[model samples]
Target: MKLNTNKAVLKPGMTLIELTIVILVLITLISVLFIGAKAYKEGADNATCILNQEQVQKAVRSHQNMNAKNDTESFPHDEVFGATGIISEPTEPTEPDNLYAGMQDDVYPVVGTAYISCTTTNGNGPHAPASTEGW
Candidate 1:
């Protein structure tokens, strides 16, 4: 008796529909993963921004402590303006890449006022100068 390799090898274990279904499932899974990953990245960026704001706050406190004549007083508003040594230069994580949006940028900040009187653009970009209030 001859071997029946041809009989079994020629048999199609999966139909065209089965192959198509498997491909579709894989595509769906990949798309979902990409979306989930994108969201995770966004969350991470926001968290980083919050932490940076906190660091700026600490730096400001340090400056105040070093310069305050009395413990009850804080750094004068004029002294705080245009000072760079106390804190690192703030920058945004995304777009514009500069600290300010533009030469004539106009934004209003409320959340991160305590540290630097600046907030991320639309609460998404990095904290920057919104007004000359905090320092």
Candidate 2:
């Protein structure tokens, strides 16, 4: 009978510390991915908000031209909003507690040559051209 002892042969699986490290790494990667996704979503939301503002601006311009209203004149919010109007309801900003979203009713079209500026001032910030901005 021959007994063979080999110290070179080791367990194939990772050690406890190695496993913990891998888990931590995976967690880190997952967190990073989540952060990136969140940022991307915010950016996309911002863009959509901007486009909505532009659409509303164009609609307001159309309304003004059709009704012969001047920029200094304040138009009714319902004039260009709704399905029957030039454009449907403009989408609000996705960010929480957005000033623009809250002040949709108070917004009017006379700001800075009817540029439609939002007063959010938050991180997602200033979703200008709010639905009421050009109304």
Candidate 3:
């Protein structure tokens, strides 16, 4: 077979503007993703905060209700809202150490807003009911 040498071989390459546009597009996409991630994280934290507040409120209400049933008025101790026991899976900035802003006035998590705000009279936190046979 005979080959023709009249045609020129060519290779396609990106021009400066084309490459710049690609880079800009990539940057925009990355920024959008980062923004979405930030928003999602904030939303997640907010939800967690709400759940913690609800749990603490529930524990407090239960304690109060039980006491009321027995013709007594008492609340769980502060220790109930701190580490070693009551609270669990606390939000990002608020550790178990600072779960309470005050004892019954207005409980605000150190990290986020306690939107629902715990009902008055010191008491506290979150954790699944569990027990162990160990000292």
After TM-score superposition, the amount by which residue 108's alpha carbon in candidate 1 deviates from its true location, in angstroms, is: 17
* Candidates in order: C-alpha RMSD to true structure: 7.6, 4.9, 11.1
Q: Estimate each model's TM-score.
A: 0.58, 0.68, 0.56
Clash tally, candidates in order: 0, 2, 0
- Candidate 2 per-residue lDDT over residues 1-135, each given as its tens digit: 877776677769989999999999999999999999988876777777777667666777777789887655666766677767677765466644543442254234554444344443336666454344443
Ranking by TM-score: 2, 1, 3
Q: What is the clash tally of candidate 3?
A: 0
Please give, for residues 26-128, the per-residue lDDT of candidate 1 as tens digits: 9999999998888777666566555555565555556656764433343444343346465555565544265522212112223335443334544345543
What lDDT tens digits, residue by residue, belong to model 3 across residues 1-135?
A: 888977887779999999999999999999999988876765555555556656665554544454453322334465345565355424423343544333444232222223133222212333212221110
Which segments of candidate 1 are over 4 A away from where they belong?
Answer: 1-9, 69-84, 100-112, 117-135
Colliding pairs, model 1 = none
Reference-based lDDT, residue 129, model 1: 33
Which segments of model 2 are wrong by more than 4 Å? 1-10, 74-76, 95-112, 115-124, 129-135
